[model samples]
Target: MTVDSRIIYGSWNLEEPTTPTRSRLFCLEPIGLGTAYVESLTGYVARLSETHYVETGMLILTQIGPLMKEGYTFDGRAGGIDKLYGRYTRAFNGASNWTSALISALEHLTLRHDLKFLSVLPWVEVIPLRYLLRPSRAWCPVCYQEWKDAGKQIYEPLLWFFDAIKICSNHHYPLCTKCPYCQKENRPLDWYSRPGYCSKCKEWLGTNQNSIQTDLGEPLKSDLNWQLWASENIGSLLATAPSLVCSPSKATISMAIAAYVEGTSEGNVSSFANKVGIEDQQIHRHIKGKTFPSLKTLLQLCKHLEVTLLKFLTEEPTVEDLARASARLPQLKNSTKRESFVIRHNQSSIELALKEALLENPPPSVTELSKRLGYASSGPLYYHASSLSYALAEKHLDYERVRRFEKMRSILESTLQKEECPPPSMQDVARQEGFSVQLLTTTFPELSRAISDRHKEYRQMLKTVRIEKLRQEVKEVAFQLNKQGIEPTRTNVSNCLSKPKSIVMQAAIEALQEVRHQLGWEG
Candidate 1:
């Protein structure tokens, strides 16, 4: 039976409404204390559906509304019904922003008093979709076991869904993606999917906590420590999302990156990409608002780039604000990794190096400058003098780009004027120049035009040479046929020659006509 399209209200309502109508069907408290923060949308919906003995499918129709009515669906892949929150916000509360819509959804659906604790919704607007959430759910077996042991309702924390977090900060264990019993992966929005239990086979997901210790190497341990730090910081940032006066903007992130990699080899986007193992093109896209990073990728970049997550997310965090947060990170006493921590106490040597580097004839790059001054990475230059370092790097990168363009133009122009051999085509020139054709055209338009003109003449000269070569081959074949007492007709000569008829061209036709006139065989 088809349902009517009008928005349904009063299908169910509370009798003698309590000030904060906490659901009685299931007294599930938010995972972190008595706060209103629920860990994930999957957990929240699963608990709500369980109270009514319904599955995810029924919850969508009854709770999330119909496809045509509100354009809501049970399966939105990784984003999962987050879109529904927006629709519900517009429909009932008439709220415009995602943060308000989220608060409205919690109040309307479950009436949970802990609406203020839910951090994900508040942060939904600020974080780019790439770093916001993951498609498949991740669970820490230790966390599940702890929740079960405490007699608490089993649920997934919103923290696990962030792509940035791989290891559990509490246990230092990696997250699990599959059910222990059935060994199958489950999507968070599956029709019958339940939190803390396998969607298939209905097995508990907490039993597969392996006792094996994760010890990859020194580098991996350092990475694990960094991951643990990031988990806590990012998690705390989300937890406080509801109370933030103004959300962190993309400009804030750009500010942090520009501040840290100054006066170093890793100052420019290309070098930064190499240092961080991300594509330079992607870095360009992210800065330009063309795309965004995933949460995991963003955190990894933060760790390597030496910018604290707190500062990056904070709107106009002071130098002291960054120092306080950075000081908490574990320092490597002996390791050679470049530290980007803010150095406010004494910066005389740093200042001297910057001055010398800036004054050099061919300005010493951040990386080269760092090497000469006995530094491992370029992070410190930005840490101490962020604005100046960034300005210098930007100026140097632009200067270097122009210098390279001029050098390439000179090389190409000189190559074209060479009298020893014919000028190479653009493709050949690009191969010798070690640049892409697109780069050649886009970065060096004037040179591209010069190459085009030279290329046209070069092609014509090659064509003439090929025709003369074909003409010589045909004449030799015709002479050979005549010496053997075989009539050198056009068809006979064509057969006599090994070259294809197409390549024989007008030269072959002229040769055949002359041979015919000499032999008086013009029929």
Candidate 2:
């Protein structure tokens, strides 16, 4: 019997189906996506490096650095790598140009379009970079330990990167800045950083199993409530990012504040400012869309206005809701009575205070004078006694210049005299003293040069030491393989070493040849 030709030819359209291109790297999904605890872009990079069995710095230098178009390049040398990882890594999680470039590079590598959600890039238009991100890493030990115990991936969340997020909303404990073992703060992304481990010491950062009941020095009830509110609201904002039809704008924020001002204070900005504890001029600037409030200030505004941060940015309050919110303004004003206390100062009292301040030794700063005069800031003092305020400020600046110079000189001379091993670099001293390396070099060129020279010598010594240790390790591994009747080949020797990645293959090959010669083996 013949088969039916219709069965073979039925619905045969000879068009080739289009297959999507494969990504170069694994497209690992970010943890807690669409939630406040979403994994940070830096955290995602660290995890990706681990998956590929390469150092994070190496991955960045090899794969992502070349893809960046904005002249963001990493030096492959050790010192340059250290500088990048130690000081410049914080920008990876922020809304800077580097963050945008890295996101584009990673998306190209992973072929995933959703990587921008891992950073604050989506909100860059409305969020100012100043005071936005923390300089160092912060984490909740309880959260780390809990995730570890549950065998969950211990990635850092984007929420912990915010400078405003001091406490963990879920754990209600203050986030830790320094490592428990090393007592050293770590950068947001280190060269060989791993999740749940100290980047410097490689020690576990999670809470100890036996110290589960340790006191965390909880804050007062009122302060704790505010911290919780700020953290939760900020988290809500991050969680709502993926679903936003359009990014939040300054106009939207301005309209919201303007609406509130009209409703609560009947278009009286000063009255509304008094209720909100923000300066009227600052409120005016915000309403005019000239500038945006910082994240901390924005959170405070939302809390006092009885609106969620997500709603305040995304939706405008209706007239009725604003009326109800305004009705509660009386209670807010009453509650802030202590904060709204106005200090009455006349012209005579201000002039008398300035005269006495001028004669005082170790002249007080304008800010100090303001506090002593019962004014909130130096603005009022300058307004009333312009000449006196200027003179006082100049004197204080001169004094401070001499004082700071002496302090920095003493610290630099002391650092040079110290007999510590692995001498600290100029960058280290600058970071520890909260000064910039450029400032130090410009101010004290000789001392900065000496420090740099000493650090270079120490680094050379370390390199010599590491080379010797690596040779010894390679020799040992080669001998062991030979004794096992196996060829001391490079691959075999490397596989036998404890840390195969730490050995330089050329050094290992040379050591293997020496071992083979010692064993009376032919080449």
Candidate 3:
């Protein structure tokens, strides 16, 4: 069952016939598509190296060969096997599904006429072409009669060709009747039979739990585990005067102060208001940078300025989410008139260079370099300029905003060193972290949003753990939640731990440590 490509005829073998005398690209009955592949492989060469072995091995897997031999789909009396058309990258070490997809795509491309045409549709074409064809086979008279005459199981003759094969009977249930390989000796391997015997070899499923995430990556962490969003730029932003990000309601005030610094006269302030979208009178009232703008309106202004949506986004997305989102991008429309569609990617070099040039310009403010990007306004535009800087920077990828625990990090480091005072309030932690006291009560919308998610995740975790017991007996479960300063109420606990997202777990640990000090817990 080891796949050795050089031992097989390989690409050339797949192309030219083995012999002019027996030369024809056709499937014969009884021999099964699996047999044809085995013939092609064994007749190609004695053996090959590991790299070619996996590469060529993949080329064979996608076709459903053994099933093809027994007539699961294609060329059989009972046909309809799935045809694989495209490939997904394969893991050479193992991962039969991925290898199968890769091989299927390569073979189909090689066989199909003008497959080059599909290359133009790279995004769509990349999807694995699963369910393309059924297995079909050719049987020689000798292979057929000897198979029938062996007095083996009716399905035994295919032993010469396939590995993971099962012969489905033409019955109402349509289940596999027997193993094509062993014929009369054994029943075919069951597909989903885990921790059970293989239908062909009657052994365990690969003898490994390749069913989990950590196992897929040999280095474990290298498999893109949800990474911590501790970017260098995040440190820079957090270091800025905390006053830079006050309550959202005070955004108009901040903008007014920024305008004042720009020397916008009172009369000119009205003009600035009209340029963005807001009341001129409101701007005059908040000119001191004390009042905030509405979170929704601030986002709208930022978007119109062509800024990174990070102004509105937080809670770093996980690797799984990113993968899912990226996968969907290939399948969706590229652009829309209202907003650039996520699918519409691949920026032009010229346009990217233009953005870089603008960012590198002195004073780098939106209005200062308006001509660089061809914009008319300067007010409420500097944010967009910063966004352009991120977009043009190759190493930096601007995605969902990630929350930086400036305060919790300090507190944890201090507390871990056993130097902190006892029982700090949640507000104390926020204040220590440079957030306002209103943060816990949802006053600071961002902090509140994060807290709400925490509550949900906490509750969910508690729900999954069934600890129905009297108060005294509930020590184990109650003690566990209490260690983190969490009440054991089904509602509160469930709400706190409801998310089950790894990010939530990480954040909650930090948040609860702050609570632990407040609860006066030494442990």
RMSD of each: 22.6, 15.6, 28.2
Question: Compared with the true structure, what per-residue lDDT tens digits does model 2 show for residues 1-523?
Answer: 8888668655778999999899999988888889988899898998999889988778877788766532234435455345444465788888765676678789889998888888887787677879899988899888999898899999999999898877778766778899988899988777777778888998998994367654446453447788888878878877988988978766566657766875676555677787888998898778655788988888888888788887887775666657777876754433232432244687678878998998989999766776776644454455456577667866876788799988889889999999878798876898799865645767999998898789878877776776678889888877787788988877777777877755455665677778889987754
Worst lDDT run of 10 residues, candidate 3, spans 118-127
Estimate TM-scores for all models. Answer: 0.47, 0.61, 0.18
Error of 3 at 139 (Å): 80
**Highest lDDT scorer:** 2
What's the lDDT for residue 291 in model 2? 81
- Give each model's whole-structure lDDT: 0.59, 0.76, 0.30
The ten-residue window of minimal lDDT in model 1 covers: 87-96
How far out, in Å, is residue 221 in model 1? 5.8
Please give the TM-score that candidate 1 achieves against the real structure. 0.47
Better of 1 and 2 by TM-score: 2
- Candidate 1 lDDT over 1-523, as tens digits, reads 7777795745766577667655533545556532222466556656667767877646654554432222233332344444444323211211123333334444556556555444354454346654355566788887787778788787767777766677888777778888777788766555566778777777777743465455545765677877777787677665665567765555445445544333323235455566666776676556434566766667777666465565566744356655543453333232243333333333677777777677766776664555566544445565665565555565566678789888777877786577535556565677777865545656777877677667667667777887787777777777788788888877788876776553346777887677666666675
Assess candidate 1 and give its lDDT: 0.59
Q: Which segments of model 3 are wrong by more than 4 Å?
A: 1-269, 272-291, 295-408, 423-427, 436-523
